[model samples]
Target: MQDQFDLDVFGNYLFIFCGGSRNKYNALHWDGDGFILLYKRLKSGVIQVIQWPRSREDLRMVSQQELRWLLEGLSIEQPKAIKKAKTGYFH
Candidate 1:
């Protein structure tokens, strides 16, 4: 049970699982002090999972930095876009 999620109030987390099939995945969630579950599947194709480190296996504990990287598709090897200030949130 490898997970990439944040425990911070402003951060989100994701859970990775390998149960269903090649086209689907399950994400058990953590809502603040509680737990929840989320599921995802490709509508017209299969989902691809990247190779993760073969060490961390606890879902309840994941780093915020790692979760940020996963959710934003940002990594050391990839060229990430310049982060600009968020605007136009409301009208």
Candidate 2:
């Protein structure tokens, strides 16, 4: 994962979904000392399809609510929800 993603820093959570069926997921995190891997599998019901970004240019940060939606088998894009404020917009 570090090599594929070109990760040079620690303290970031990387979420990985299995292809086909999509019933399992792996969460990889760097805990400053070593890597920790967490895996989860649904007993029933497959995880909803997510429109994942295909390229580096499409990558963006997601909020806690968005992560929750994803785990609950929902899209992260909440069209009706208030959007997060951009950095340095007030200044």
Which candidate number maximizes TM-score? 2
Per-residue C-alpha lDDT of model 2 across residues 25-89, encoded as one tens digit per residue: 76767788987887778777766656555555656677888877767666677779898788875
What Cα-based lDDT does every candidate model obtain? 0.49, 0.67
Ten-residue segment with the worst summed lDDT in candidate 2? 1-10
Winning candidate number (lDDT):
2
What TM-score does prediction 2 earn? Answer: 0.66
* Stretches of model 2 off by over 4 angstroms after superposition: 9-11, 79-91
- Candidate 1 residues 1-91, lDDT tens each? 3243323422355555644454556665677777676655555554433554355442334456544444443442335645446787765
In candidate 2, position 74 carries an lDDT of 63
